[model samples]
Target: MRRRFCRPPRLDLPSLFPEGSGEALPAVHKVASLGTPRRVLALLFPRLPVERLRHPGPLAIWAAQGSRRIVLSLSPEAEAAGLEPGQALADAQAILPDIILVPEDPAADVALLDRLALWALRFTPLVGVVGANGLLLDITGVEHLFGGEAALREAVLDRLARMGLSAVAAVAGHAGTALALVRTGWNGLVPTGEEEAAVAPLPLAALNLEPTLMGVLHGLGLRDIGSVAAQPRPGLVRRFGPALARALDEALGRAARPITPIRPPPDMAAAHDFADPVVTREGIEAALDALLVDLCRALREAGRGARRMLLRAHRVDGDVQEIAIGTGLASRDPKHITRLFHEKLERLEPDCGFERIVLEAPRTDPLTGVQEGLGTTGRTERREELAQLLDRLAQRVPVWRLAPRASHWPERAMARVSAFGTVEVPDGWAPRPRPVRLLRRPPILQVMAQVPDGPPFRLRLGRIWHRVLRAEEAERIEPEWWRDTPDRLPRDYYQVELDSGARLWVCRAGPMGPDARWVLHGHLP
Candidate 1:
């Protein structure tokens, strides 16, 4: 009779191999042909250094154990200088001559892991985070869905490799056993009834015990799991503490260990992997349309709307093209997003064909209220018509040309104006009695005749003669004395109407000081 085996609810072993084959398997052979089958994910944070935390800015840093380079998230200058995660400050300086160091952003890493978890859910839901940089997935029952266990493993490895990820994997009866096997360079499946024996030769460090406990184990000459298991349970518990004893028991299958699987979010992201690369605007648009439609359906069914959408186009040459667009309002309208993308598509040049398109909306807001009578000749229609006109004008003229003037200083107000989109003017801003156009720098002038503290008699501005008709003497203003400025000039300003009916705003520089001069500062439109 064949040996009876019990399978738990979450455990499925038939998916791994064919059933009922009564063949004796080798207990512990380091098979050379298959090589080391440790499944490991090396999260290489390319930027981080000890010195970077001093000044806070856009960049972040992180340090990893056993890593030579300091990981930094700075620009090319920082990376080229040899900064990476976990590099010593002095060592980093020697390695990278002039790179700046920054503190690591744990928040960003957590967010990245969240995204990775979402992506990994497509393969298996039994994913768990291993430290800050690695993830563990229990591909038991799910492996068969991809084919046999070997084929599924190969597929996973191949997919990750194609996505430019360096990962290693191992399959075993338990997670701890699998982790130990993978870390110790044992990548294949450990035979039945041999989980304990398989992990026995590995180091105590593989059990993920605390460093203090590991040091104690080392001092006690308990270097490997086999040595630790040889000790009496009560003595082990009393000497090394309960944690180490528990870890040992769990490794030996004397205690049960359970793993909590990572769950995917309610909303789903849809993507497509192309058999061949597509390198045209039309191709990108087509791919985007398909992804948008699928994602929209998912959002609709979930009663959600996306406020921000991110499109990632994977190129054939391994570069990821990311395009992010934020809507003015929360919208579940697929056509609106598609149209916006269509408008953006004209500006993009796909040098090489894309292999995949990933549409992700990690941020979503509830649909507020339905917009009724959208196509009618009301406020919405007027706004749309105005928008179309603005777009046409933007195409002909620069966007900045249509922007409004921004200023707080009444005298120097309206000096520079940007395009409409670039400037965000606040609502309910009442215009002051200031000139519509103000000069950036007031021009110095020579006065023919003038009263000491009154409006000018006759002003000669750049060889042009102007007669003052009605003079309006505005208040005299002084510069902020505390602020050091060698070029700061005291001024007596006058808003005068010219004899020709034009208005000119002028100022007399150095009103009470030496080297005083008259200047035509600005004009009132």
Candidate 2:
């Protein structure tokens, strides 16, 4: 059987965000932002898996199921030849013996869909991937930029045509409404408040129910969405389950679905559009500087500083180039931030010149005003100098700082933290005294102690013996019970001054016994 008669429901749109409350809604249909409905543009690639390869032929992609090979997707030509997906390879060959069959690559198809979704960001930053062959763009406030909804749809469709991909697209007040319309081969704009009238005549296949549920509905002579929605909802939910009712409600705009964007919209961003494409390096830099000035003013007004900023260069040829920079300290200085991107500006490939430049601060930190010290060489000045040095060094290499972690275990005592952030150590929390040179893995040593449970009097290195002139009181160090294995043993560490005047820190594992091991942990300076 072919998918020509089947409409795959909006099954993968995660119903994560619920209405009114924070509690998760049951997995029925994905809904979000209960009040004013937003416009969603659903783009469906009818033959993505085959088109991605760009192989010119009557191609039918197949996958092996046990001993049987079946058609999974077909190229435009194969579909025109009456070859459909789900048909057995042997049967398909009988119809067209010269058909070119390629194995299905679902992973490649998914990756291409993700890339296409990113490319769709040129329309709106809020683009979402639907299943393996579709994309949903939340073009709510973005329609006016490309003239209107109809013009925006044509711009998108025309762009795809140039890219050599066949796509069917629809715009509706609800994502589910848009998705259902496109899957059922219905194209055009379904204006807000008129979703029911537009979706009613579509086939029940647009509801995208389970195959068995579809068969049951077909047996009951309910072929179109209007007939199914006309029946009492309680009776349908009781017999066929809630999925059918939910799908119908979503398509009719009674419910709303949110598009989880591929990239979360930036916290703050500024964009500049040029009347003509900017091809020269100086022109690109000027555009970037203009964007940064606006972006920095916004940051200063919000009392915030950007820790990481991203620059997206939208080329005239429908390609996006991105350049990102991270700071050692959150900053809003336009000139300083511009200097950071000086070395990276050469990396921007101005393919056919860039028509638009967008600068976004994906991450920001609170930068409230603070009182400065009276002296000229104040703490603020010192901090600014330090930040400048770190930022400069970070441009050439990765830079970070060490912060203390609250753990008794030596290995867990420290953590690597962002250099831009402050490390807050709790008051009265003192770190354990550690030797100057501590070994990650302590070396084994043979030791003779005056008492079975006392400190060592003599110790043997690889080929030499050192007599202990004096030994400090043993310090018992226990393993962190919550973190260490149950069978792990405690150690008694001792600082010893040897006959040769060399000081060594040694530890004995567990209680004094034949199995007790002596290890040189570090050299005490």
- What C-alpha lDDT do the candidate models reach, one value each? 0.56, 0.78
Worst 10 residues of 2 by lDDT: 1-10
TM accuracy, model 2: 0.83
Q: Model 2, range 229-279, lDDT digits (tens) per residue? A: 999988998988887888998889998776777877666666655667888
Measured by TM-score, the strongest candidate is 2
**TM-score of each predicted structure versus truth:** 0.50, 0.83
Candidate 1, residues 17-115, lDDT tens digits: the string is 111223432211111122322221212222212222334333335345454444434544454554553456556667665555554667766666655
CA RMSD of all predictions: 14.7, 9.1
TM-score, predicted candidate 1 vs. hidden true structure: 0.50
Query: Total clashes, candidate 2?
Result: 0
> What shift in Å separates residue 476 of candidate 1 from its native position after superposition?
5.7
Task: For residue 167, give model 2's deviation from the true position in Å.
Answer: 1.0
